[model samples]
Target: MKQGRSLLASGFVAFLLLSLAHSTLRIEPERSDASPTISDPAALLALQTRYRSLTRQLTQLTPSRPYIVVDTARNHLFIKRRDRIMLDAIASTGSGTILDKPGETAGQWIFDTPRGEFSVQSKLVNPVWVRPDWAFVEEGLAVPISQADRVEPGVLGAYALGFGKGYFIHGTLYPRLLGKNVTHGCIRLNDDDLKSVYQLARVGTPIMIF
Candidate 1:
């Protein structure tokens, strides 16, 4: 009887050891659901090259006739004709000042030379400056109610090339302020430069300000 009990206990121990070994030594199946990731350096470079080519094709400006290019930050203006530069002169652009109005109907004005493509809509000799509301407000004066009060003569020098929205490339009485950012929102040049530009730049001529 004693021998049989001992043999039974030995068999139980062997069974437990085998069960523990089987539980610990598991072999999970390899994960086949994950997608593979691959990177090609040449493919990335080819995409970048295509994007640059498209951008260059889009931004290339090929003017057939005379065009004006204004460099506002440098206070310079250049008139170009095909491949030749017709006129290059010092200029005065916007002052970039801000005026704040505080009230229910209050608004603000940013005196900046707008950057984009524009065209000469009109030309005037001895152009009168019909001062806007901001002009009066800037000087700390009351805005006039009558139209006659806004008509200030002989301020826009000898010539004016009107782009839209009351902006102009015109002559300045303040010739000393040339090559400086001093205008309210116009391009100011010396009398000689203004005369040349006014005569050369026709209506519908392209003007690019940067």
Candidate 2:
């Protein structure tokens, strides 16, 4: 909505292209006055049949329940119920930075946000961030042997929605960094947006990232 375009419209266009790939006729974006029309009634009928089938598939694929859509490229997150968008907020996603592992010769991590479909697996209030090894390494601090040394408080806003494998949609201390790709891998939202998300989402709420 920030861009004044529905992300679902892109999906529909993609679906239409995929559906047309299997058909004999092609739909061109621009045409001259002499553009050929389907003179054969049978071919026109086949095209109509494919249209109906594709429409049905798209309708069936629409989610009935509320879901999250993260547009990592645009740095925006949306909460949508079917065709209606419930919330659209500026967010910070993965930075795509490469950090070398301290001990391993070739080991490194590319901190790009994970894509594809995922669901909210856990939600926490007043979340505590147990800082990982990368955090210490990035800061050039010595890695602590004790786990207690890793417990960090207050930096990760008030709420966190975990989507498994150490990734979360959480609050950020630097709300000014919203709309930028500057996170380790988690999605960072402002406090107000995060609170709304935490209240709206559930344990199994679907999160679609792209």
Candidate 3:
């Protein structure tokens, strides 16, 4: 009976040891949902340094001389001289309307203000608007082959600054529509604003339109 009891105790101890080992094997490690942390300090510093360099390069690209900026979306103009705003005026830009010719292929004109960097190519006082073919078609008037019929006076107001390819920053007779997008492609301003822009901006003055 003593030997049997001892044998029973030994078997019980063996079973307990096996149970403990099974429980240890079933245990799992804890998990995380957060993103991985950056371990390298040098890569993070290099990214910050590149961002600062780009900002400095943008500041250097600004013009030192007087420049014109046209905001087509807002119908506004800003004349700046070396980071100072010389004039801020309400202006008219393109109407974004399409003029289509009936039964003609590739004969449509989209009246959109061209966006990019341009320069003042010419300046005119008491300017005459030589009406183009589109003007006559728009008005339902007969297209005149002669240049004399196309010449119109007192329509361009007192001053005009031509940029390039027939585009101009000019005065408009329609002063009530100064802040409206009502032009075919030109930039129109009120008399006082136009005079200010014409006098301040000279030939080769940079004009950035966006």
Best by TM-score: 2
How well is each residue in 28-84 modelled by candidate 2, as lDDT tens digits?
434676675788899889888877776666556555667788989999999977567
Q: In terms of lDDT, which candidate is stronger, 2 or 3?
A: 2
TM-score of each: 0.70, 0.77, 0.73
Clash count, candidate 1: 0
Give all candidate RMSDs, comma-separated: 29.7, 7.2, 28.2
- The global C-alpha lDDT for each of the candidates, from Candidate 1 onward, is 0.77, 0.82, 0.77
List the candidates ranked by TM-score, beginning with the highest: 2, 3, 1
What lDDT tens digits, residue by residue, belong to model 3 across residues 43-139? 6566456545544443454465677888898999999764478999999999999998644556898888898767788999999999998898888
The segments of candidate 3 whose C-alpha lies over 4 angstroms from its true place after superposition are 1-55, 102-105
| Candidate 3 colliding pairs | none
User: After superposing candidate 1, which stretches have Cα over 4 Å from the reference?
Assistant: 1-61
Cα displacement (angstroms), candidate 1, residue 190, comes to 0.7
Top model number, lDDT: 2
